[model samples]
Target: MPERIRVLHVEDNPDHALLIRRSLEREDDSLEITSAASAEEALGLLEENGFHVILSDYALGSGMSGLDFLRAVRDRGHDIPFVILTGQGNEEVASEALRMGANDYIIKRSGLLQFKRVALTIRNQRETFRARREKEEVEARYRHLVENVNAGIALARGDRFVYVNPKLCEILGYSAEELTSRPFLDFVAPASRETVAERYRKRQAGEELPSTYDVWALHKDGREICLELTASVIRDSEGISTLAVLREVTRERETERRAQRMEETLDLVFRQAGEAIFIHDLEGRIIEANPAASRLTGYTREELCSMRVQDLHVPEEREFSENKLASARLDGLFGFVGTGRCKDGTIKRCAVTTSLVRMGERTLVLSLVKEVPERMTSHEEEWVAAAVDARLKAALEKAPMVAVQAYDRQGRVTYWNRASEELYGFAREEAMGKTLYQLILEAAEAEGFLQELRRVWESCTPAPGREWLTRDREGNRRWVYSTIVPVVQGEECV
Candidate 1:
C-alpha cells in the first residue's frame, strides 16, 4: 500500500488554490491536499489536523506574508515541512524564503504545468523530513543505552579515549572531560599496562587477538582494582576506534584465590596429619582416605577405596557405628568411642569424630579416627588373670578333638588354646589376639564368616556348626567344622 502524504495548501487566490490541488491530485493519487485561504486559516487547521507538508504562496493579500507565516508556525512548535510558492521572476523572494527556514520554494509559471513542480517539491520535502526524524530517534536510543548500562563503556582512538559514558567516568572516579583528555594507559596499573598496551596496539594494527581479558586498573584514589574488559575494533568513515566494556571483578577474583589457598592447605594437612581421616558417601562407600587412614586400617589406599566404612568395623560394632554415623548426619557433627577391626583382624579402641559436609550438590561424611592407647596396670593385669578359672583353662589346653578359642566382641582373640593353634598350624603366639578369620579363614570366606558371627552376637545363640574351607598362615587349605556362640556375662551377652 502506498503512503498517504497529507498536504495543507495556503493561498489567498481561490483560483490558484483550486489549480494547485487538482495538479497535486493528478500528479500522485497518494497525496491528500486540504486548502486554506490564508496563513491565519492554515494555522487554525494545523492545530486540529496533522500534515506531512505545507505549500503556501509568497504573498498573502492584506494579511501575513509567507515568511511571517513560517515564523508563526515554528513559534507554535509545528515542524511540518514548509515550502513557498512565488510568482514568476521572483527568484530572489524564494531565495530569501529558504534562508528564513522555508524547506524549499518553486516559482509559479503559467497554466497547470507549474503545479507539477509544487507536487514534486512537496514529496521531496516530506521524504527528507521522515529520514531526518528517524535518524534523530536512532541516535537518541543509542545514547540512552550507553548512558544507562551497568558496565563502563568507552570509545578510544589511538591511545586516548574519544568518548566515555557516565558509567566509565564513575568507575574511574573522574569526570568525562578528565578521562577523555588523557591517554587511557595512564589509568592502567603498572603490572597490566604492558599487556593492555600490546593488545591495543595489535588491535589497531588489524591483528586479531582475544577480545576479552582481565587487567589491573588504577583508580583515581591510587588503589589497584581488577577489571574484566571486553573490547572490539569498530571501523567507520572517521577511521578506526576501539569500543571497550569494563566490569569490576575484584571481589570475585579474591574469592577464587581464597578458595584455592584453602584447598591447598587442606591437601597438605590430609597428607601429613597424624590421625586417620576418611571421606565417604551416604552408602558407606569410601571415596577418599588419607595416608594416616591407610596406616591405621592396615590397608592400602586402593584397598580402602574398594571397601565400605562398615567393613572397617568388627561385626559386633556394626550397629553401633551405624548409629553414630546417623547421629553425625542429623547433628552436623558427632563423636564416639568405637572399635576398628584392622585388615589383620587386630582391633583397636578408637575415638571417632564424624561430620557431614556439603560440596556443590552432593552430601558427604568426613570421619577422623584416633586410636585410644590401651595400658593395664600390674594390679589390673593380675585381676584379669585370676578371673579365668584355672581348671577350665587346663581342660581347654588339653582338649584333643575340640579346638577351643575365645575372642572378644570386636573379634580380637582373648585366648587361643594350644590345640587350636595346632589345628590351624599356627603357634599360640601367632593365633592369640587375632580373629578366627585372620588366623584360618581364606580372604574370600572372611566376610560370610563374619556375618554368621554377627548373627550369633546379636541373637545371643549358638550358630549352627558349618564345614569351612580355610587357609592358614602357611597358605594351606583345610576343611573344618566351626561354630560361634555369644557368651553371657550376667544379663548381657559379650
Candidate 2:
C-alpha cells in the first residue's frame, strides 16, 4: 500500500481553502489535508507536524507573504515542496514567486482543476532528492571499504586500470591517478607476466584456482617484490570485468627455498658418508647400510643385507653381541671392544659402539665399528721376532731400564730381548718360547702380577712401569720394573 500524501494549505479566504482541500482529496483519496487561515498559523502548524507538500496564497493577509513563508521554511531546513496560489494572476508576480523558491504556481480561479498534475510534479521532485541521497550514501560506503581494506585491490578493463584503491597504490608506490591511467600488466615483472596471464585466462574461463602463488611484481620505483595474487571476475548485467588482490610474500618464499636447499644438502651428506655405518632393527638384522659398510666388511651389498649382525662377530662372541645390543636398546648407547670376523675367515680387533635410533614409528640400532689394528696381530710369527729384536736393542743399550714385553693370550713369549737375558740370567733363545713366569719364579707370586698380566693380554691394554720382585734363573731375587703391551704386526695383533 502507498503512503498518503499530506497537504498543508494556507489561505486567507475560507472558500479558497475548502476548494483546495476538495481538489487534492478527489485526485488522491489517501491525501490528508491540514488547513491554516494565515501565514502565522501555517508557520505554527509546520513547527508542530510533518507535511509532504505546502500550498500558500501569494497575498497571505499583507505583512507575511507567500515569499516570506517560503524563505522561513527553507531557513528552518524544511525540504517539503511549496506551491504558490495567486488571486491576481500576473507574469511578473509568478516569476518572482518562482525565483523566491516556489516549486510551482497556479491562478486561484483554475488552481483546483490542475491539482493532480501539481501534486505529481511535487512527488517526482521528492523522489529525485531521495534517489540522489541514496546514491551518495552507497558511494560513501564503497569508498570507505576500499580505503580501509588490507589487501591491494584493483579494477581493470582490458589492459587499463579503471580503479585502484589506496592499498594497491601503497603496495606499488604509485598514486591512484598514476596507477589507473596505465596498463595493469605494467606492474607485473617481465619474468612473471606469462604465468600471470595463464592464470588470468583460467579465471576468465570460470575455472577456480588457488589464489596464492609466487610471482614477481614491479613497484613504481622499479624495485621487484615477490607477491601472492588472487583475483575474481566482476561483471555487470552484460558480464565482463575483473578485480584483483595482491599480497607481498617475498620473505616467506625466500625462507621456504632456503629450508629446501638445506634439506637436500643434508640428504646428500647422509648418503655419501665416508665411514662404515649400519642401521639394524631390534632383531639384530641389518635394515640399512652405507656403501662404506660393504667395502669394510668384504661383502656385497646383497650378501650383507642377508647377514645378521651376530654373523659379523666371531662365533664365540655371538652371546656378547646380543647382550650389547640389548644394553644399547635399554640405555641408548653401549661401547665394547671385540673381535670381528671378516668374510674371508680373518678376525680383526675392533671397538664397536652401538646406539638406538628412533625413526618415525620404528626403532633401529645404529652401529659404528672402528678397526683396532694393534690387537689383531697376535698370530704373525716373523713380525713378532722382528719386533722383539728391535725392543731388545733399545733395552740393552739403556741398561737397568724398564723391560717391556709383548705376549700372546696363552703367555707364550712373543718378544724376548737382550735386556731380559741380562735382567733374568737367561738367553733370548731360551726365553723365546718359555713363559716369563717360569724364568722369574716370583713373577707369579709377586702381587698377583702374572694374573694381571694375563688380564692385560686378553684385554690388549698396555701395562707400563709396573714394579715387582722377581727371582732370577740362578735363584737371585731382584726388584725390577716391567711393562707389557700387545704388539701389532702388519696391522694385526700378535
Candidate 3:
C-alpha cells in the first residue's frame, strides 16, 4: 500500500508476459513489476536488488527450466516467494514444482483470479513457513530432552522397532542393534499381545490412549522379564509411530500372579451369586445367559439366545427397551430398573446394566441382571425410591436455567419435576415412562447426555453435566442440563 510490491517476472513469451503484467497492474496499482526474457537475465538482475516475489514460466526458451531456477535461487540462500506459471496443469509436474519449494502455481489460461489467488497464497505461505520453523525448533528441543532421559525409550512403526535408547536396550537386555531390527510385538508376552495390539490400533486410529500396560520382554539371556511399559504414539503428516518408556516391574507381576491365584481360590464364594448375568450385542440379541438368568427369566439358555430384549418386554415396555438400546448406542451403557416378563408370563422386578463392548471396529453390549427380592419392607422400598427421587430432583433443581429429567434403571419415568414439565411442555403423566430419548426431538443431544452418564457410571465417579436442547411438545427446542447418579439398593448399585 505504501510503495507497492516489487515483483520480478521471467517469461520467454512476450505475449503471455505482457498479459500477466497487465492483469497484475489492473488488480493493484501498487504493484511495481519488472520482466526478464530468460532465467539468465533474471539471475543477473537479482544480483543487484532484492525482489518481493518471483514469477517464472515452467518451460523457458532457454535450456534451464523454472525448477532449475528455483534450485539456483535456494542454493544462493535466497528466500523470496516463487510462483510457477505453467501452460499445462499436470498434477505430477505441479507436485514436483511444489516439492522443489515453489510458493504457488497457476496455469496461464486460468485467468486473473488465479494470479490474485497465487499472490495471496504466497503471502500466507511465508507466514506458515515462519510458524513451521518455530515448531521445528521446539520439537528439536523436545527430542533432545527425550534422548537424554534415563528411562528406556524406544520408537516403533507398527510392530517393528525403529529406534531404541541405551536405557531401554539395557532394560530389555539387548543391544540397540538387536532391538531395532526386531518386531516389538515379539517381546510382548502372549498373554498381553492382544492388549498391545488393541492399544496400537486405537493410536493408529488417532485415539489418545494412556500408555501404561503390562508386558514381558526378552532379556539378553533369553529370559522373559515382566515389565510395566508406558507408551504414547507420535503422529505426523505421514503416519503414526510409537514411543514406549519401559520400567522393570518383575516384582509387581509376581504380586499380580499371586493375587490372581488367590482370586481363583476364592471363586467358590461367588458360585451362588444369585444375580443373573446376561451378555448381549448392541441390538439386544442375547449372546450369553448364565443359569441364574435362565431361571429368573423362565427361559432356557437355548430359548433366550433366540429372543431379543424387546421380545421379553410387554408391548408397552418394548418401546422403552428400544429407546434404551438406542441410547446405549451413543452412551456406552444403559441401566434401568424395570419389570421383565418371564417366559411363564410373570413380571419380575430386576435391575439391568448394559455396557458397550468394543471389539475391533464393532461394538456389542454386555448386560448384567439382578433380581430384586420381593420380601422387602415398605420402609426399605420407600427409602430406595426416595433416595433416587431426591438425587433426580436435586439434579433438576440445580439446573435452574434448563430442564432436567431422569429415566429409572428400568427405562421408566422415575422422576419428572415442575421445571421439566414446564420446559418440555409435557405433563408428568405424558412424559413419565414415555421413552425419554425418542420423545425428545433432539435425539442426538439426548444421546450425548446419556453417554456422559454412562461414562460416569462405568468409572464409578461423578460425570460432568451435559448441556443439550430438546424439543418441547410444541416442537420448540428448549435447553436442558442432565446428569445421572447411580442409586444403590441393598447390595446392588443401579
lDDT of 1 by residue, 115-184 (tens): 6777778888999999999999999999999999999999999879999999888888889998989999
Question: Model 3, 1-494: lDDT tens per residue?
Answer: 44556789898889978987787777666676799888888999999976777888888875688888988988888878788877664667678888988878777567567668655654555556567778999999977877778788888886788888777877877788878787887777677788888888887788877768777767777778887788787888857888788878775566566456645643432234465766677788887677777888899989998988778776778888888788766655445655688988997766666665543355567666666665666676555444433432443464433455666544456667777777777887788776667577466765666666566556644454344567878788654444454543322345
**Lowest lDDT 10-residue stretch of candidate 3:** 265-274
- What would the C-alpha RMSD of candidate 2 be, to one decimal place? 24.7
Ranking by TM-score: 1, 2, 3
**Candidate topping TM-score:** 1
lDDT of each: 0.81, 0.72, 0.71
- lDDT for 1 (candidate 1): 95
How many Å off is the CA of 289 in candidate 1? 2.4
Q: Could you estimate the TM-score for every candidate?
A: 0.69, 0.46, 0.36
Candidate 2 residues lying further than 4 Å off, grouped into runs, are: 1-139, 197-212, 237-239, 275-494
